[model samples]
Target: MSRRRRAEKRQTAPDPVYQSCLLAKFVNKIMYDGKKSVAQRIVYDALEKFAKRVKAEDPLAAFEQALENAKPALEVKSRRIGGATYQVPIEIPANRRISMAMGWIIQHSRAKAGRAMDERLAAELSDCFNNQGTTIKKKDDTHRMAEANKAFAHYKW
Candidate 1:
């Protein structure tokens, strides 16, 4: 880690269609090998599919809700103090919470077999919106672990 002053966060432009920086960040996370256009197409197609599934509901709103549902309130961090390492329960930072939710969503979607990327993403988003999906499970697990390790929370810096 650098000892210098923390660097300022770079600003990200919102997605053209949705006008949402959050959605743009999600698209950037989905991009691989610098293929941003391909990533954008996949995300847009998935959002369209999701919109079709829920009549009269905006896909962007659904996506935001899904991300909120999947966000972990607490997480355990390994901290070394003196001679022993302890799992310290800590509240997640806001930006990190969003990033982690998006990561889990994409990760679980990629784990599905025999499906196109767009379809898999759509399914994952829908499931997340309903609060019943792999991402939600992962979030629950994190909270559980943090709860179990609450005794060590004082070890947090």
Candidate 2:
């Protein structure tokens, strides 16, 4: 952690369709090479496709569901003391937990077998919303690992 005083929090505007700042942040995180337009188009396209699959609600609900399923409640961190390394399991922060979930979902989506970015994103989003996907699996794996290392929870700060 930095020794300096904590910086002021900056506000982010919500996306036009969902009116959610979290969605805006996720779009920004998904952007590659600083191409906001491409990221926006891809996310919007995926949302449109996802919205069609589930009736009565907007795509943002699907996005939120995916995020909820993908977030990891706990994670392990490496720490060194007296020339020994320890894998300490700890609860994740709220903001960072969400960011990690979104990043992993986007990354795994890109790694999937799909013809287009939008298609991959849509598929991943659908799976996550349904509680089954690479991202959700990853979160489960993390939880399992944390559970296995429950004895090390005392090492957390």
Candidate 3:
């Protein structure tokens, strides 16, 4: 809530191999301590494994579908009106939806034990593509919360 002008949206450059902006963004999200090369290697490896796991001829398409499946359409936001706090349902914007999906996928993948990051990510992606995984479960939870809070949506400013 800065008083300054809104920041302009910066366009991400497409990834070198897939020429996909979404994939590039996903790689950037996976990067830690600015080690983009390591992140890219891991993500690319996961994509390959995911393609083989799902028997997908187009890994990018499969990955996109998995990401889409993990994206939540609605979320609940807390709004304070007349000294009362309420949970207001809100539609998520496009960029937030994509980032949330990527974050959830990465976080859920990282939580598993006894697996490399790439292998875990590949398994999670395939599970998500099939509409059954932690990410998708999180998405469903978000939608459910939003639905339950629909009565408070009028409190949105």
Candidate 4:
């Protein structure tokens, strides 16, 4: 029997304004109700605000730094060994790391009250850029959990 190959990843075009694929991915993640334009506007406005807040000459660069700071190096995965389940420490791939970081930023921003999405995203990005936000805490927690489960590293198949 032939084995099925993994599906190809759909390619995303860069954002019109900044021409950055990373920003476009972020916009797509923020999109609601199939509103791509609205998501783009919110993200662009937040990046502008982030630029001012971080005093960055290039907001995209600063945003990349924030994203880098939020990416977790390790995470624990459940593995069934014998009759017991073990939490195996595993390294995250680059794409998954980026996806997870973006999700955390959006989640924390959406959790905030009394602010527009752009405002909240801007604040959250600034916090992430400065390495002091819920997103960063989440990443840290993931790392800590993986570290605590390093004894199960051999269980990873």
Candidate 5:
């Protein structure tokens, strides 16, 4: 962490094809070793696959809905007070919620075997859109943990 100053958030330009900043952010997160073009291709292909499966609707809409479905409302944070550790429930900020959803979707997609990256991502996205994927399950688990630990929320400060 930087002590002197908060880091400035670099502005991200919307993707060329979809013209969406959120999608651009997802693509950036998907990028590795600075291979943004490869990431873009993968994501675009995945969206196309998702569109074909769903039929009669925009894939971008499905992507956004999937992310929204995976966003967690609350999460637990560990805090120490008086030699005791507690799990404090905290509300998730909007930006964090989106980023977490995106990360989980990518992570779970990567975990699947025997498929190309685009196909895996498309499958995961479709699952998420229908609220039946690993990412949604993870979000539900986080909410459950937070609900269970609500008594410790006062220690959050």
Candidate 6:
């Protein structure tokens, strides 16, 4: 940890189409090795495909819904005591919650057996929006773990 005061949080600009800062941040996280354009293309393409398949509203809405469904409320953290490691259930921060949701969704999508990125991402997003995908399953597992270890809640500072 730094002894000096932490730097201020920088403001982020929204995405070009939806004008959502959250989406922009998600895109930044999705980017690999500074390939931001590729990330943007993949997300936009996935949204476009979803919009065509769903055919009623905007793709951004679906994306937002997916994010909402994927976000986890609580997670268990490992804390060390004198000899044993305890599972401490902690409430996830808002920003981290969103990041984790996105990461899990993207990871599951990448691991799926799909022919194209758009198809895989769209499938994952749809599953997430419907609360029936790997991401949501992962969230459920986390919550279950946290619930199972609720006795360690007092260990949190």
- Candidate 3 yields a Cα-based lDDT of 0.95
lDDT of 3 at 134: 87
Q: Which candidate's TM-score is highest?
A: 4
Give the alpha carbon lDDT tens digit for every residue of 20-82 in model 5.
999999999999999999999999999999888767278888889888999999999999898
Clashes of each: 0, 0, 0, 0, 0, 0
What candidate 1 gets wrong by more than 4 Å, as runs, is: 1-3
Task: Compute the lDDT of residue 22 as modeled in candidate 3.
Answer: 97
RMSD of each: 1.9, 2.0, 1.8, 1.0, 2.1, 1.9
| TM-score head-to-head 4 vs 5, winner | 4
Answer with 2 or 4, whichever has the higher TM-score.
Answer: 4
Please identify model 2 stretches exceeding 4 Å from their true place: 1-3
Off by over 4 Å in 3: 1-4
The 10 consecutive residues of candidate 6 with the worst lDDT sum are: 50-59
TM-score head-to-head 5 vs 6, winner: 5
lDDT of 6 by residue, 18-111 (tens): 8999889878877889998898998888888877766628788778877999999999999999899999999999989998998998899889
lDDT string for model 2 (1-157, tens) is 8889988988878987778999999889889999988999999998888777655277887788878889999999888867888889988999889989899989998998737999889888888888887888999999998899888788887
Across 113-135, the per-residue lDDT of candidate 3 in tens digits comes to: 89899999999999999999888
Error of 3 at 61 (Å): 0.4
Candidate 4: worst-modelled 10 consecutive residues by lDDT: 1-10
Better structure of 2 and 3 per lDDT: 3
What is the lDDT of every predicted structure here? 0.93, 0.87, 0.95, 0.95, 0.93, 0.87
Off by over 4 Å in 6: 1-3
lDDT of 5 at 86: 95
